[model samples]
Target: MTIELYTWGTPNGKKASIMLEECGLDYSVHPIDITKDEQFGAEFLAVAPNNKIPGIRDTDTGLTLMESGAILLYLADKAGKLMPTDGEERWRATEWLMWQMGGFGPMLGQAHHFHRFNKGKADYAEERFLKETQRLYGVLDKRLEGREAIAGSYSVADVATWPWAARFEWHGVDLDQFPNVKRWYLAIAERPAVQRGYSVPSAQDIPMP
Candidate 1:
């Protein structure tokens, strides 16, 4: 089945593409240029009412989905790969994925906005987000202290979280400071599927810490 992947070149967008690549799924990429307000177009709105990047239509199942977290889980189940099958490992994977969704991604996005894009516009916002960004990184570092992957193996949690961490520079994060996280990030970065997915809809080098 050919999946229709509607997305832009953003962290969230890369999540779906990365999962697709990892699953060895056949898919077509339809670039939605959010910078040009293309996401608001009626066609995309039909697929993603939230007007966000990284929505997909699975021709095999005729299932349309939005939200990066949900998409990762769906693809994992469909592929029967990149996720734990049962018990605590599955829930652990889900937990870390939600951690990325709830805290890491949003906080890092704010860090990008206040610290990178709109620097000097708001000192308080910059400091606040940056502090939170570092805190979240510490949490990740601790979680990764003795693990190769977030949950256990190379699962959807890694797929969901790695793209955001790829933008560590934008968040002004020095991966060197979070040693465990740096190690985990670098290892995941070396994956062939991750390298392929990171460039979906366009080609861009993955940033090194």
Candidate 2:
């Protein structure tokens, strides 16, 4: 059975879509326009009580899942790919995944919120978040040094972090400054599946209400 993916075009949503594409899973997308408050709708809330994008309903297991990181891990396990089953490699992949979920993602999100979305300039907040975002990017850049992918391979860690990193410019990141990350980013961006996944839910398909 095909998976039912509830998502949008944002980074979190792209995570699920990319994972599905990477896993070669058959799935259908249900676009959720969070900007229009569609995520809070009773129907969407049934599958995602948290009222967040990137939820999924796996018909094969009759399981409903939320949180982009969890969803990626679940899909990786379900497919028996994109993640090591056990060993240091497995833990390594998981470690970076957590780092992304707990640190990189949230920090960059706040940076984008303050720097781009804020109507009234919040100078202090913008500066704080942007600096933190840069720090996190620096960490990622160092980790990518002498490596092609996070956790040493293209695993769920890569899948989870790729979407957010793709918006580096929006987060005030200079690709030239983080050459290693830029290389990794460009490599991932060239994947056909990643390309298709990033294009999920065309902007014309979901109008803000």
Candidate 3:
């Protein structure tokens, strides 16, 4: 069951690689260099119509998938791990995963664009995204209080969120301000699979907050 993981070093891309490592699945990496606009090439588009960095083709099932969140769910189902089988726990895990897909990742991306990469070019965009980023962090911190993982027990929720939180510095986030999130982020950082996955297709140190 070798999965061909099409990805880069971004957070969303890391999610697929990290889950692959966690599932102990045999896989190969195909680096889609978004930096050089290779994702837009027709060949890559055949796998991921959205032209996204992280996509996958499961050789055993002949399934090609796009979108990091969808890929996570599919891999969990295929491996029968990370995701809960039933009950409130399952829904709770799904909720947090959705939260990451909707708010955490997208907002932080905008914050990174405005606050970090293009600072002063659009002050209003910067301020709006940065403020939203802080609010989202506060929400996550509160959810993490007295909890080890985002959805109780390490699951897809944690896998989805941790990579985004790993980029705290890029979005002007001070993990110190969100102690619970900081603790959660650090705890996940220590996982051997996470350490391996964070450097998928290339080697890069996980940024310490």
Instruction: Put down candidate 2 lDDT per residue, 59-131, tens digits, no spaces.
Output: 9878998899999988998888899988998999999999999998888899889998992588999989988
Residue-level lDDT for 102 in candidate 3? 99
Candidate 3 Cα misplacement greater than 4 A, ranges: none
Candidate 2 Cα lDDT to native: 0.88
Better of 1 and 2 by TM-score: 1
After aligning candidate 2 to the native by TM-score, how far in Å is the CA of 6 from where it should be? Answer: 0.2
Candidate number that wins on lDDT, 1 or 3 = 3
Rank all candidate structures by their lDDT, best first, as comma-separated numbers: 3, 1, 2
Task: Tell me the lDDT of model 2 at 171.
Answer: 87
TM-score of each: 0.98, 0.95, 0.98
Q: What lDDT score belongs to each candidate, Candidate 1 first?
A: 0.92, 0.88, 0.94
Candidate 1 residues 1-209, lDDT tens each?
A: 57899998899999999999999988999999999999999999888899998899989978899999999998888888989999999999999999999998988998988889999999999999999999999999999999999998888899989999999888888899999999999998999999999999999999997
Q: lDDT per residue, candidate 3, 27-145, as tens digits? A: 99989999899999987898999998799999998889999999999999999999999999999999999999999999999998888889999999999999999999999999999
Q: Clashing residue pairs, candidate 3?
A: none
Off by over 4 Å in 2: 203-209
Cα error, residue 143 of model 1, in Å, equals 0.4
